[model samples]
Every structure is written in C-alpha cells, then in structure tokens.
Target: MIIKRYRVKSMNEAITRIKYELGREAVIISQRKVRKKGFLGFFSKKILEVTAAVNDPEEKNKYENSSTDSVENFKKVVNDKIRNQKRQSDFNYAQSVNLRSENNEALLKEVHQMKNMLDDMSKKSYDSLGKSKLELKLENMDINKKVIENIMNKVKEIQQDVEEKKKLKMVIGNMIKVEDKVLENAVVLVGPTGVGKTTTIAKIAGKMSLIEKKKVGLITIDTYRIGAVEQLRTYADIMNIPFKVVLNIKDMEKAIDSMKNCDIILIDTTGRSSKNKMQLSELRAFIDRINTKNIHLVISCTTKNRDIDTIVNGYKELNYNNVIITKLDETSTYGSILNIIDAAGKPVSFVTTGQNVPEDIEVMNSQKLTELVLGEDIIC
Candidate 1:
C-alpha cells in the first residue's frame, strides 16, 4: 500500500484528481486539515491538507510492478538528460573545431601573402641592380672583381628592411659579449672627450669593487684636462679604490707595473676631443704602452648624426677594438649608429644609459642593440 500527503487550496479537488489518476481502489481517502493564520490570512485565502492511501490487491500488484518500473524510469530520465547534454556538447565542440580550422587557414593565407610580397621585392631590387651594373659596365668598359662584388653587396644590402637590416648588422658587426672574457685585475678605458669615458670607467670600476669584491685601482691618463684627474680621484675616493696620476706613456707603463697585483686596474683617458688628431695620437701612444686585450671606444648617442662619421673617422687611426655608445637616455634617434657601424668596421662593446655610477652602464651585446635600433618591427 502507498500513502501520500498533499497541500492545496481545496481538499475535494485534490482528492478528485488523485482518485481519477490512481483509480478508486488505489486512492483511499485518509484525513484532512483546515489551516487558519489569524483573521486577515483566513479571510484572504483558503487552504487545506489531504492524505490518501492505496489498499486494493490489483493496486498492490500495480505498485509492486511500478517499483521495478520506477528504477527503469529513473534510468530512462537520466539517459535522456545525458543524451541532451552530449548533443549540445558535440555541437559546441564541432563549432569550436570549425572556427579554429578557419582561423588557421586565414593565418596560412596571410603568411603566404607576406612571403610572396618579400620575394617580389627581392626580385625587383636584384633586377634594378643588374640593369644598373650592366649600364655602368658598358658605358665605362671597366671590369674589376672588387667593383663587381661591391655592386652586388650594395644591391643585397639595399633589399633589406628594418628587421633584415638588424640581422645584417649583427652579421657585419660581430658584436662580442663583454662577459665572454671578463678581464680580471685590469682594464683600460680609451676614447675621445665628452663620450662619457671617465664615467664609464668609474661605473665598471665600482661594479668590480662592490659587486665582484675584487681589489680595484684607477689610473688616469687625462692629465691635460683641468679636472679630469680630480674628477676620477673623487670617484675613486668615494669608492675607496687606489687612484694614480699618469703623466705620459712612461707613467702609464710604470702604473701598470705597480698595479700588477691589483684585481682590476681601470685606466681613464683624457676624454681628449677626437676633432684634434694630435690629441688622439697622443692617447694612442699611451695605450700602446699597456698590454690590454680590448680598448673600448666611448661615443655618446645624443650626438648629431653627421658628427658620428667625423668622430669615427678621427678615431679609426687608433684601431680601437670596440665602440661603447653612451647617453642612450638622452637621445631618440639612433640612425647614426648604423652610419658608425658601417664605417668603423668594428662592433659595440657596452652601452651606458645614465649618470648613476656603476649601475647605469651595460654591455651592448647583439640582442639589446638590435631591439633598440629596430624598434617595434623586429620580432620579440
């Protein structure tokens, strides 16, 4: 027998519906209750509770049959819900997969277009160069292997965009890492005046002393300048490193001899103007006396583009190992770097950004210089 309780506005209506659905033998009327919730609630609404039960043998057999049927019914309801969910999920998955395929195809097409455009550009430049070379050869009737090579190389270089130019710069520059062979015990800073040469020395000297815990010494070949030695002396005083005054090539020779035991000996140049060839020659003489592996050429980036060629031309006589561009924070344009790189036939060593001692200067390896030169176009 099955009994059920129900709440409704009218017990008679509920009982009538139950009897019709379950049959008179199945639904046996049990009890009723009238609810009252104060005067207002009672007057506003009517509510009643009804109870019913099943007692007939036919009804009992039907109930027993339904008990097993109930399980199957529940399973069917669950299966229907799962089927609906699976269908929705499959539809969503198919939509997503189709969208992804479309996006991939579009990306492939775009890449193909870019490649075609690049090939067309290359062909156009090569054809133009070939035509020009032919005209020049026929007009002049001069055939030199070097001249032909130069023409071809110029043509290739002209075909490159900003990103391609950066790669070419790296290949041409062959910029070396500063840390690749860190000179221990001694270093010499040689460059023209106003290129932040003294400050660069101080930066590296302080870094060696404070961070590397190496016993460092400072030597100055800037005796001609009024406060060059004093300025370096002051920085040395602050850092508590030994500072020595160099009078000539002889003095530099002896200074290195005396500081042979020191971990790092940073030599400061007079920051002599490269405009005066004599001054650069005098500094080169002093550098020749020292047995240093690398000589860093300090050049400020804020300088005018035209001045880059002049400065580099003046310093080329010394055959300095690398260029160190300084004052990057002070300039916006860097096209001069390209001009210098092309002319000097040398690579960059370090780049100094600010006036903060030791902390502001950094080694200008290939990647950083490429990014700074190429701006937004070079792939990160």
Candidate 2:
C-alpha cells in the first residue's frame, strides 16, 4: 500500500486531494487536529492532519519482499521532513519576534508623542481654574461651552466618590430628555428639505407595522420631491399597509378618514426650506386637517449647530411636539443631540443612524443616548 498525509483546512479538502492523488480506492488511515508549529502555537489556526492510503500491487510486492527495511526507510523520510519543518518554523518565529520588537518600539514612540501633545493640551485647558479636564474633554466633543459649564456645575453638586466618566453620564442622563411614548393615533413627520424626512417616515412606519403589529397607514403630501411618494409607497406595499397621497387640505382630510380603522396613522409632508415662509405655511395647513399631537420635526445630526437652531426656530410655527434626529452615523460629534434637546426644549422621539429602513431607527433612550453622546460606544 502507498500512504500519504495531508494538512488541510477540513476533512472534505483532504478527502478531495487524497482521492485525486491516491485514486478512488484510497481510504483514510488516521486523522487528528493540530495547530501550526510556532511560538504562538495556541493562537495559531487549527487544521486537520489526515493520513490516507491506497492499495498498490507493485508496492505491496516490494513491501512483502523487505517489509522491515521499507518501513524503516519510510520512517526515516518522515523524520527528516519533520526535522526540516521544525527548523523552518524556528527561523520564521525568530524573524517574527524581531519584526514585532521593532514595531512595538515604534508604537511606544508614537504613544509617547500623543501623551506629550495631550499633556500640553491639558495644561492649557487648566489655565482657566473654572474648567476641569472633563469639561475640556466635553468641549472637544463639540458640546456648547455654556452647556458644558451648566452640566459640570451640576456634576459638582454630587458628593459621591464616583468616576468622572460615570459622573458625567449621570449628569447628562438627568439633563437630556427623550419621549418614550408609543406612537399616538395620528403622527406627522416634517422637516426642512434634504433632511431625510421621507426616509424617516418609512423607518417609523416599518417599525410600527412590522414589529409592533399595528394597523399602520401611510399618507404622503410630499409631491414637491420627485419619487418621494413612490419611495414611501414601496415601503407601504412591502409592509402590506394602507397608503394614500394627499394634494390639498380636502385630500388630507379624506385620507385620514379612509385610514381611521388603522391603529395608527403616520403622515409624511413635503420637506420645506426653513427660509421659505410660503412652504412652511402650506405644510401647516395640510397637517392642521389631521390635528396630530405627535408632529415630530425631523433634523439631520450632520446639520451645523447654528443651522439646527435655524431649522428648529423656522419650524416653530408648525407647533411640532417632538424631534427626530437622523443621520447620527454620518457625524462624529454628538453634541447636536444634546444641543437640540436643550435649545428646542422638545424631547427627542427617535434617532436614525443610517439610511436603512426600520433597522437604523431607534426610539430615543435616555441612558443609551447619554452614553453615545459621551463617546462610550458607537450604537450603530
């Protein structure tokens, strides 16, 4: 018999190669799991060591004539291969260790440089006795300085021996507000143009209809944007929910009446430029027909702090009750979330992390939001 061994990723791979090299009559003699021979033996990838053998008439005759000699020679050859593999592995391990040592030295140097830069910044920040290191950190996070002062002042009131990060989280949790209520009977989403109002509607509608099992209805008065109505309609169709298009106040009233049987109705209005008084007034007229108490002003997190103030103030006339912050994934700074809450005095109803429908939107959670704002972790 002729025998061979294979070190492969899986039994299937070994079997395929063995069959090709040792013929269809080949049979597995032994198999075991082994890691690559190296200093990082436990960390190395594990693979299958399969020994396969096949019947060979010529080899069988030679083996019978001098079976002992043949076996000894085979063992010698196997030992030689193993010894060479060990030598090669040792050489590779030495080279890897040397390279890693050099890399570690460079890494330590970079870390020292970073530490020096941070030390300089800390010294400069502390030049003002009014600001703590944590306060400076918050300012770097783009939180309004006034807001940071307010939060820090509040944090100083607590007398517990708590960690600074935890203290900040506690103070922020109490300071920021979020609306945790379920969707009202009639809800409307409005925002300035290009703030992802339509997509936010779909995300909310999807969660309500598919996840909450609510009899959800979708109505769009967003004819100003091309494909806006179709985009929402597609989401409605997929969810197998009722959908309608309203062109005027009369159309809006009729659409609401038709979906009166639905557990909740989600309305989508045309995005208006905050600068356009005429557009905002027109949107107000349409939503007035539904008389929704849950009108959420949608805004993008990527909006400049000043622009967010503009959008919020411009839409103030619409009497929106809550805020929906979208595109949280697109920006590095989260101060806008706290900024809007403080600026508008309206609790955030939801926050959208991406463009995905349903999956990317989260109903505002106070503790989680605080952690994210503090750079504890990326929720997305």
Candidate 3:
C-alpha cells in the first residue's frame, strides 16, 4: 500500500488533497488535529493532519482492468440466461398449445385490471389540479415557505381534480422515505432525553417479534437514568424477549454476543443533551462497538423548530441517517417534521402517533404524514 499524510485547514481540504495526490481510490486511515511548531512551540495554530493510503500501482491497475471485464462478463451471462429462458418458454408454449386459450383469458384479465388502475390514477391527477385548499392548509400548518413552494410547484404541473386529500398525501409522502424492512440484525436508537427512545424500542421489538415473527432481543445502554434499565427489562419480560444491560464497551459486546442468534436486536441508548459534546461522544463510543448501520435518531414532533434544528445539528457528529419523529399526537401542527427533514436532509423511518406501544407506531408513509400535517383525520 502507498501511504502518505497531508496537513490541511479543513476536512474538505484534506479530502481534496488526498484525492488529488493519492487518486479517488485512496482510503483515509486516520485524522487528527496537530499544532505547528513556532518559536519553541509556544505559539502555534492547530491544523488537521490526515493519513491516507492507496494500493500499489500494479494491484490498482489490475483491479481497475478486472472491474470492467467483470462487468462485461456479468452482462453477457445475464443476457445469455435471459435468451435461454425465452427459448425454453417458447418450447413449453409449443408443447402446451391447448393451454394458450386459458392463458389469453388470464392475460386479458390482468390487462383490464392494469387499465383500471391507470385510469383511476389519471382521474386523481386531474382532480389534484386545483390545490388552493392544499396551499392554504399548508400555510396554516406552518410548513416552511420553501418546502411549501417546492411541493406546490411540483403538484401544479399535474392538472387533476381527484381526491385532493389523497393527492396531497402522495405529494407529501414523496418527500419522505421509510425503512419498513429490517436490513440490519442489530438496531440502535439515540436521541435527547424524554424523546421516548425506550418506548419506541419496545414498540419496534414487539412488532418485529409478534407481527413479523422475528426472534427479537433487547439491549439497553441507558445506565445513566435510575429506572431506565428496569423499564426496558419490564417490557422485555412482558414481551418474552431476551434483554441485557450494558454500561460500557465490554458489556455492550458481551450483550450483543449473547443475542447473536436473535433475528433482530433492538438497542436502547441513554438520551444525551445535544449541547453536551462529551456525553454524545461517549455514546458514540458504545455505538461504534456494535458496528451496525441501523442507528436511528429519535426526536419529538412537539419540539420547536429552532430546538429541532439544534438537536439535529448536535447529533450530526453521530452520523445518523434515519430519523424517528415521536409524540405526533401531542402536537397540533407538524410543520416541524418538514423543517427537520429539510434541515437535516435525513429520511424519517417511523412516526409515533400516540403512547400506545406497537399499535400507535407506524412506518412513515408520505400520504398519511401529509394528511397529519394538513390537520385532516388519518383513518388508520
């Protein structure tokens, strides 16, 4: 490997230098702040020192050449498989020529169903053209001006008068995305205190275990609160799910190991004050030990937009890409959802509508969220 170090003013500058000198394939090894020596090192300015590495020229060249060849080969193999399947299908049709009449009936039925769906969508699009009510409702709900404008501009292009509520919901839903499926075996929930992280964990664990039939395990790292551990333990006992408590990195690792057979392990982290950098950093250390991609930052929808921005900014260092907005029932206006989504640029995974565990929590869907924001009753 070719390794080199560069000193730069900022992370962006360091990255640019690494890419320029070591190529885009280079990997960042480590980075730290270092002070330059000036007059016996008494007075100096701090700069970022970044260490990066790249593979040897021969290995890099060979890997690059093989990548193109591999892609071409993969495409050829896929095409050949497709052609073989087509030929096999043709042979089967010739052998079963009498079945063609029944197959045509089935195909015609499917085509009619598809046409009906398309016509319904087209009518809905035409009904959604007059969005005056939507604009007024969004304004009353206190959604951000720019976000409202963007949604309006996009919706105005489709001149349809269908169910305005459903149309509006679709438009709003398009702005958010959710991870309804469990991709990672272990998931961690992090957020400020009183954001309902513990309860949310229980809700998710219950759903996965009861509804999805996944073997669920619960782990809590919220040792700071006096009753936090007991609370989660009680829930675990009621749900008949295995539970563990971790106070440090070693405990966390052991807890995770104990739940290795679990289909999904939900972790509850101690809430930290966003302003407290040391606490957030400490929490990050415990999370780093787990090495999971499913870290969700929980926030309350009732929080003011300014505080929401602060919380989102403070948690940025934790690198949380998914957000769960809780306490939706407590708030009248949900403009904060859009505000936080826009400001943080993170997709909301779930929204907790009430205090009811499992039942109250719903995977965020654009249409439902739009209805909630517009002060319309959500049927579900």
Question: Where does candidate 2 clash, by residue pair?
Answer: none
> In lDDT terms, how accurate is model 3?
0.83
Query: Where does candidate 2 stray beyond 4 Å?
Result: 1-131, 159-163
Please give each candidate's TM-score: 0.54, 0.64, 0.59
Clashes of each: 4, 0, 10
Ordered list by lDDT, greatest first: 2, 3, 1
Runs of candidate 3 with Cα error greater than 4 angstroms are: 1-136, 149-171, 378-380
The TM-score measured for candidate 3 stands at 0.59
Give the TM-score ranking, best first: 2, 3, 1
Instruction: Please report how far candidate 2 places residue 309 from its true position, in Å.
Output: 1.0
Cα miss at 105, model 3 (Å)?
Answer: 67
Residue 274, candidate 3: C-alpha displacement in angstroms: 1.5
Candidate 1 residue 303 Cα shift, in angstroms, is 2.2
lDDT per residue (tens digit) for residues 1-380 in model 1: 66766666776787786687555765546655666568676665556667777666677678778966887888888898888888888888788778878987998899999889768666443344455423243223222333334433654655546554444444423422333347565566666677899999889888888998888888987888888888999999999988899897777778888887788788888766678888888878988888666676778776655677677788876777777778877755443454455556577667788999989977765655644543422211
lDDT head-to-head 1 vs 3, winner: 3
| lDDT of every model, 2 decimals | 0.69, 0.85, 0.83
